[model samples]
Target: MKRYALQPLVIGALNPESPVSKHRQLRAILRTHAQETCKPGDRLPPERELAEYFDVARKTLRQAIDSLVEDQVLKRVVGVGTFVAHPKVDLQAKLTSYTEEMHRRGMVPAARVLRFDSVPAVGNLAREMGLAEGTPVVRFRRLLLADGTPMSLDDNFIPEHLVPGFLDDEAPMSLYQRLDERYGLILQWAEDEIEAAAATVENADLLKVEIGFPLLRVTRHAYVDDNLIDFSVSVYRSDRYKLFVPIQRHGMRPPRYTKITQT
Candidate 1:
């Protein structure tokens, strides 16, 4: 039999005489356990073992697992076993804080500030920054790092009127954090688009990846109170990063499949 540090909470709440089905109660408890403790890709006990431990029929146990699998909270592999699914991305549009996203993945984060200067914005950059065609703006370039490894390169332009002391201070790991903490720039909302492209020769040299490797490019425009505050272009390494965007469809359920086996 497979062993686990199975918590008592998983089976402690069942009432043999309750109105609820024992299978239902067991399913609820197991779902809670996975949410609170299990890492993505962690495997659960086999169906037979769970059925025996919960004192439920095999059919009942299977039904409970199936429901959770549909919820995207759990997944089963045919030849292996069920596991917690890694996060998935949604095609629907949304905004995200890069700092919070990286920290959640258990990576040590850092950023290298390459250039910080107030210069005359030109062409479309001035328009994006909500300035005159050649208005002065702060241009910044940074290399975002995870676990001391280069993961992405970011370039941003902000109107000088919005961030007064931005160029004076040394940069931090997260520009968003610094904006709110230092300049009192409250970021109300942002719009962004993501796409895939091959790393250019310059990008490959800076990111330490092979030239022409696939990369994820994200372009963003951030705002505060109907005012355009920042515009940025970021490029990320494809091999080192996997994006997870959760989604729910309107009709039929999504398919579930497993990819790993346990010894």
Candidate 2:
């Protein structure tokens, strides 16, 4: 098999007299070169060549690369060379399924059902789903993928009565789509709360990241016609995903002005 190499556009040499450090200058130069010349998933040149070309020590070159990796501008495989990173997915605050969101971004979406079974609702599950204790509920654990890369681990719970035969093998990739098409239960609205978390050992393996990496935990409650229908806890890789919320000032009372009395 032919191996492809990453070729950054040639740029001016770094200025030693400048205030900026050499490593920082190298990082900036490489970032611009990568953005201009390399596509996502393009493999970078060997470390030795890159270091020699920049006339910097290997340690300094590695530092620059590490910074880019942390910023998600580049990705480093253990044995493989570094590569350009795909743009992070911006998740808007909206009622949409993972499949729909990925499709809108022109990326292929897939799901692997890690666990699907009927479990009795208890504790917070019962309270959140508004179901009696011991009521049957469909539990779905799925690994959501985009463009063949794992994006999130979703644990979803829904009232079993609302979705019959949900444990079958032929489950759809999009739970919302299945609900609407099979059970006529369309999601009307949802509320989500996002917080930063550390990836656990199990989640790290599933998400292909190192343990304790930063992650975004999103807790969601979906409703249909004012009835709580589904609840889910999804953990997303913070490096590959971001949440976008639009904020605007509304309903603020204008400054009260008193009419000035004529003298």
Tell me how many clashing residue pairs each candidate has.
3, 0
The collision pairs in model 2 are: none
lDDT for each candidate structure: 0.73, 0.81
List residue ranges in candidate 1 displaced over 4 A.
Answer: 1-97, 242-263
Choose the strongest candidate by lDDT: 2
Off by over 4 Å in 2: 1-29, 39-83, 252-263
Candidate 1 lDDT, tens digit per residue, 90-125? 222233455665676676667788888888988877
Estimated TM-score per prediction?
Answer: 0.57, 0.73
Compose the digit string of candidate 2's lDDT tens values, residues 1-263.
Answer: 01222543346468989999988998898788678878888888888877877778999989999999887888898897888887776666567788888898788889988988899999988887778999998888999888889988999998888776777757678888888888889888888888899999999999999999999898889898788888999898887876665444587665432111100
TM-score of model number 1:
0.57
